[model samples]
Target: MKKSRLILSLLLAFASTLASAQSENPPPVKEDFKPSVLNQPGKEYPQVNSQGYVRFRIEAPDAQKVHVSLGLGGRGGTALTKGADGIWEGTTEGPLDEGFHYYHLNVDGGTFNDPGTLNFYGSVRWESGIEIPAADQDIYALKDVPHGKVEQILFPSKSTQTSRRAFVYTPPGYGKDRSKKYPVLYLQHGWGEDETAWSNQGHANLIMDNLIAAGKTQPFLIVMTYGMTNEVKFGQLSSFDITPFQTVLLDELIPYVDANYLTQADPAHRAMAGLSMGGMETRTITLANPGVFSYVGLLSGGSISMEDLEKSPDFKKNVKLLFVSYGSRELDNPRRGPWGDPKENTAAVTAAGLKTHFYVSPNTAHEFQSWRRSLYVMAPMLFK
Candidate 1:
């Protein structure tokens, strides 16, 4: 009897300990996910939960392996498991950053777009996109307010020997008042993306519309054009020459815009801003042509050091607004560029009596989210 009692006590203690351990673990995630806002009109496979966890469902019946190219760190991506119902499904191991993310699928070692989501141009190709629902998404949302028109134009580029395409955004009341001329902001996209990125991916027009509607910012004209003039590969950054692109932008695009549109055609009324490689181009072109653009912005691109200003004698006098920004994640490593910290560079410029501004997008990386917010913050401060 004593032996049996001891055995029973031991079993009960083990069971209690197991129960406690189970109780300490987190509960299974709730099933309240919805289709991503970037999904196709009728498709509903890629979904995101309130916690920012992305769930994907693909209908590849015979594929041996299926993977999503978006997840946590590195590029391991998310592997989908085939279920008994012949559908491959999986959820991200952790939450993703809140904003637009470009991703695709690798099915049996073949690259393909997720049929459910709308395609965005990135990484030199059209890839699937998903939005994680940013908390401040309303800033770029389409409302009933007065809207702006994004006009597409083909400008003659003698340097590139082609009629280059550019998109110009005219503010809400632009057409109403034909006598009034607005300041122009020449914006550029990242490496692989072209001019369409600012309107399509970054929602530049909508951001300007919302800001103008709320009387938060003055109405201005925004011009976006292809930043690449030479055919350079992805890995060949050293060979990427800015001379050709600078000529096209400064000589061709600017002259065409000034003649065609009602713009305040002067250095003080002109600004240049770009993202990533576009930012690099902005830094180069703005510094080189200091008298052409008075306002300069570099979003997640790089910084402007005191040495850069010293090289350009007119930069301190001609430039008015020097706006620089980056994603918080990109700043984790202090070593950003050859000039070292971007914050310090901006400070040095500000100390030199130039109007400088710096911004960091929280919980984001070197993606469109950072650039979008940068535009929003920089718009109000331009031509002021």
Candidate 2:
């Protein structure tokens, strides 16, 4: 009887331990092993093929209706066929443009994502689907044209701490001849844009290449650099540091170009110009560092006043030709007109005994079209 009692007590203790361990740590669940999509798949997303039309599959267990929204003017609701596997799928017509498009999957009572496609974008903060080599492919990238060499060069700036790299565009005839000297153009991009903005979005390289090939403009080096400091973004000029960038341009970029290529170091052969914030930077640099640049161009410049010109001692003496161009559309309401106008300020500078030329293009407002036209008009005046 004593042995039986001891055995029974041991069995009871073992059962209790097993029960406690089971309660603390259960077996591995297959639901936990499933991916995020399988766990809560609801919205169906559209997929883009090489031809461009979007198609996709959606799996909504409790959905009554399903539809997909397309681009700019795309709208429709097509019933999806419920498969034996409980997945609904449908295809849209073909050949969509190769750009970004937003879409959402609408189900019966709610909407969800497409579990079939990995590509997705946010709604309020929705993701987008990107198509390449479809309807709206890049024209230049597809063209069989010879592209000039572009390089990102980092140097010290008098304006910033770690300095930045500027994009330098050397024409086709850059290094073939040893004794050829090229004029230099210091082109600037607008706010939130870096040196690559002109070459990338502005198509400046194409413009220059065509001009040089046709003998319209002389072969020259284009130096595109960042014009604003970090402090400019925050609306605080007191914290801005530009001495380093200025030092880099004068000390590093210029010397390097003058040594590597046949360049005229004199101010008469160099031109400085920019758009928006870059315009302000050009104005400031040209006025402060007199005799460093002969020609200065401003496109849709913002918040410039007579005070800025009157305060600068070098404004009248050093500047040879000041080209002030603004879009006629922007001189009116909103966007950029209310603070201070470029046309009014240019007139003020002209009245202050500075040589200035003003032109306004029609139907534009601080856009790439305005800047492109500005460059087309300004390049001829450079190194003249």
**TM-scores of all candidate predictions against the true structure:** 0.91, 0.59
Each model's lDDT comes to 0.83, 0.58
Clashing pairs in 1: none
Q: Per-residue lDDT for 1-384 in model 2, tens only?
A: 343233223322221210011122323322211122212244334444444444556776556667655422223434566777777766543333332333456677456654444333222223223332322122223244444566677766444556567788887857778777778888887654566668755667776766665566776788887655443543333344445456666777787767766787788888888876567567667767877888888776543356866677666677788898876555543434322556767777788787877877554444555566677667766777
Measured with C-alpha atoms, the lDDT of residue 41 in candidate 1 is: 97
lDDT of 2: 0.58
Off by over 4 Å in 1: 1-28
**Per-residue lDDT for 81-170 in model 1, tens only?**
999988899997777777888889999999999999998887678889998889999999989999999999998888878899999999
